[model samples]
Target: MTVPPDDPAIRAQGLVRSFGPVQAVRGVSLEVRRGEIFGLVGPDGAGKTTIMRMLAGVLRPDAGEIDLGGIDVVAEPERARAELSYMPQRFGLYEDLTVGENIFFYGELFRVPHAQRRARSGQLLEAAGLAPFRRRLAGQLSGGMKQKLGLVCALIHTPRVLLLDEPTTGVDPVSRREFWAILYDLRDSGVTILLSTAYMDEAERCSRLALLHAGLVRTCDTPSGLKRAMAGALVAVVAGDPRAVHAALAGAPGVLGRLLMGDRVHVRVDDSDRRVPELRALLAGRGIADAAFTAIEPGIEDVFVALLGPEEAA
Candidate 1:
């Protein structure tokens, strides 16, 4: 089916799913625009995987509707799935097969013509920086290389929509950056992407993000918009002893919330001007006088922490 360029590439409405006793997705709804990267950001067990599965037409939602490229996914899963490629956390890559073999096999599975498969494989492998390793066995590749291989296989058919579930979970920093570069290229080439990630930094790279918590979407907006929606001013308390700083600020007035960010304590307050001095005095009285406090803009993680609170965020 030919989808209109102006319509959403993917859409879900009041999606609900369950696993016997656990309700994994609760009325989740979101839309992915064409040629953009839309991200589902949350901690583990936050229904990211479940929602991705549903969006891929691999798992049916108990209720709600899903449309992919203008096709009714729930009613015609096979047709819907043909328009999208889903790369799960553990993509099915045959360890014994060479990278080229895996891509060819997936192409056959997708029913691409022999000549088209060859051309597409060459292009995707080159784009993913795996052309040199085409003959290398999948099992012998590095973690990042394996991920890129999986992605190449998934893109073999050049589907309209791509769904990734934590594609860079255990990948090294450099590989993760490289993988994101490939995604940016795809988006530029007009492929719509919907990905789920636990990494807040990765979430910031998306064109828009949906912050999920406890099977609910707390908020959905651009990263900057979400940060601007944060209820309080964020103050970063930098001290040699982060635990001591946290203890000192415990129960302090005007403090909305507090979270530990590496060596610093990010404390949210209604008024930083009034509370910064009070917090400083509180720390000084505890014999800690050299602590530094700076007002900082909230990152994606900070916004998530504020929305879910420090406990649920942890």
Candidate 2:
């Protein structure tokens, strides 16, 4: 079931939260339509976790409103939480309990009736490739397997919305891919997922994203929409001396900014059509003429740097 245009599955308006002197989230507002994978993409200390906590009803917002499937989450946290699942970076799993026991424990916590719990647990474990390890203790599982089990436990109640905080961080590449595949399946089954992630590539997999920085939102849009909103042309330059190239292009006319990526530099200019030749001339003038120049599609990292004026794109 697609989200109705008029009623979003998750809505936060003018949300604010603080820790003593530091304001973690400052009046952030966002909406997640049902069945969409909405991403909270940001670097460390970007208030992603704070916002997620508020949405999960674990932290009370000092001000503003939070609604989950039309329930007032900020006021009636328990009621709202019943319709959502929250899987944090480090999920609380009983190390000594078998996978099946852990699933049943969470099922009991959510008050899922025994019969439904058995069926749902079986289905989730199978979908997560953990059916064979039903008797394995949680601590004996691989990091990926533990995470998968955590997801299964969180999903025991089959809530309408799922909130995940940096779910793929520190996971192996293959495990990360597998976890994302599971997410796709959930979204296809009409579960609205709101997840926070620092990885740019992971952010790309979302239907839409809110780019956060230092307790403020830099921008929010679809990956392509964010890139398209970037106000200039991008060019990639590979040079023998990338430092020298950066120094030459720093503050150059028609150049907006430049970022170093390995031995190459991504330069954004007001108009590459008119400025690339000049850039080439400048590189040659600096006693480096063999630099390769190519126009490339703007990646999210490039768009982030352009929008935020910083290079924290990881």
Clashes of each: 0, 0
Give the backbone clash total of model 1.
0
Q: Which pairs in model 2 have colliding backbones?
A: none
**lDDT, residue 136, candidate 1:** 93
On a 0 to 100 scale, what is the lDDT of residue 228 in model 1? Answer: 94
Native-to-model Cα distance after best TM-score fit, residue 63 in candidate 1, in Å: 0.8
TM-score of each: 0.97, 0.95
Best by TM-score: 1
Which ten contiguous residues of candidate 2 have the minimum total lDDT? 1-10
- What tens-digit string does per-residue lDDT give for candidate 2 at 46-67? 9999999999999999999998
